[model samples]
Target: MSKILIVGAHGQTARIVIDRIISETDDSLVLFLRNSSRLNEYDNNSRVELIDGDVLNTDSLVSAMKNVDIVYSNVGGTDLAKQTASILEAMTKSNKKRLIFISSLGAYHEVPGKFGEWNEQAIAAYLPGFRESAKLIENSNTEYTMIRPAWMSNKDEIDYETTQKGEPFKGTEVSRKSIADFVMELLSDPTQHIDESIGLNKPNTDGDKPEWI
Candidate 1:
């Protein structure tokens, strides 16, 4: 079984991915989080291991990288660029090649018009970390797949479509569960999305253009 490491494993999207992995596969998991107390919820599983550490600490990250085959980074913070740089540096030293990074949709400045205005507003509110972190990953040597999902909701549906580095998906929202499902799928098969960055969103089923257009 591939040994996978999940950074920020307690986050909403990470929780969904972890649950899916637990139910569907026998793969071993190492969950890295800032606090060990929060891990009580996932402690019963024998296949899961918990590590308490900050992603910005290269020593901690390097120690965690040992024997880890794949890494899914979900860390979020004000210093996103620096944190990602630390992780990338450690991964390079350890020679761990596969990475799945979660970024925000407007990181490429593709949102246009009024929707673009709204996107910029929202991005201004919450995208500095994702943008800088994604920049770090884009410049790294590790084989990586960066997924930027549109405004996330908590709906537990998997109905969604993907766009690759082109026009951003024209949706107002994408379910976090769907993003989790996509991450799980990527983990199961890394070859399909290697070195690619993509956008994801729910498809237009009501014959109306999504708000993000």
Candidate 2:
């Protein structure tokens, strides 16, 4: 059974993935988050280990990376590039590879039309950090796939499609469930989508902006 290390395990998508892995696979999980108490629900689970740690702490990351076959990072923060850099360094020190990082749409300015303009204004502050993160991951030698998801919703459905780095992004929004489903698919075969950045959105969700806003 593969030992998977999930950084930022408290994240919504990570929580979904954790439940899925526990129910569907024999994989063991190391759930790392700053506050492990949030995941006390998994305390009795033999297949799971909850760790109270910060991704910025390379020493903590190195300790957690021990014996891990893959790393799935569902991280959200203001300094994405900095966090990504630390993760890569920790992986190298730990002699591990394979990373799945959650990014956002427009990292490469791939979105098109008025929607693109609107999106830029929506998350203008954090866009550059994501773009820099893409560069860091791509330039590194480790096997990594950056997941750039469009506006997310709490809807309990899994209907989504993907676009490559250079392709104009499709649709307007995708459910967190859809993103979680895609992440689980990647975990099933970590060999796929290596060193690539993918964009996700729900089918038929094309719009100048998300319907909610």
Regions of model 2 farther than 4 Å from truth: none
In model 1, residue pairs whose N, Cα or C atoms come closer than 3 Å (at least 3 residues apart or on different chains), thus clashing, are none
The C-alpha local distance difference test score for the whole of candidate 2 amounts to 0.93
In candidate 2, list every pair of residues with a backbone clash. none
TM-scores, all models, native as reference: 0.92, 0.98
TM-score of 1: 0.92
lDDT of 2 by residue, 115-148 (tens): 9999999999899889898899898878998999
**Per-residue alpha-carbon lDDT of model 1 for 1-213, expressed as tens digits?**
788999888899998888888889988889998996797777888998899999888988889888988999887766777778988998998899999988877878765566667677755856777777777888889999998887787876898888887675556578999999899888788786998888888877321334434
Model 2 TM-score, 2 decimals:
0.98
Q: Lowest-scoring 10 consecutive residues by lDDT in candidate 1?
A: 204-213
Find the candidate with the highest TM-score and give its number: 2
- Which candidate should be chosen as best, given lDDT against the real structure? 2
Relative to the true structure, how large is the alpha-carbon lDDT of every model?
0.82, 0.93
Candidate 1 wrongly placed segments (more than 4 Å): 205-213
Q: Where is model 2 poorest over a 10-residue stretch in terms of lDDT?
A: 74-83
Residue 88 displacement in candidate 2 (angstroms):
0.7
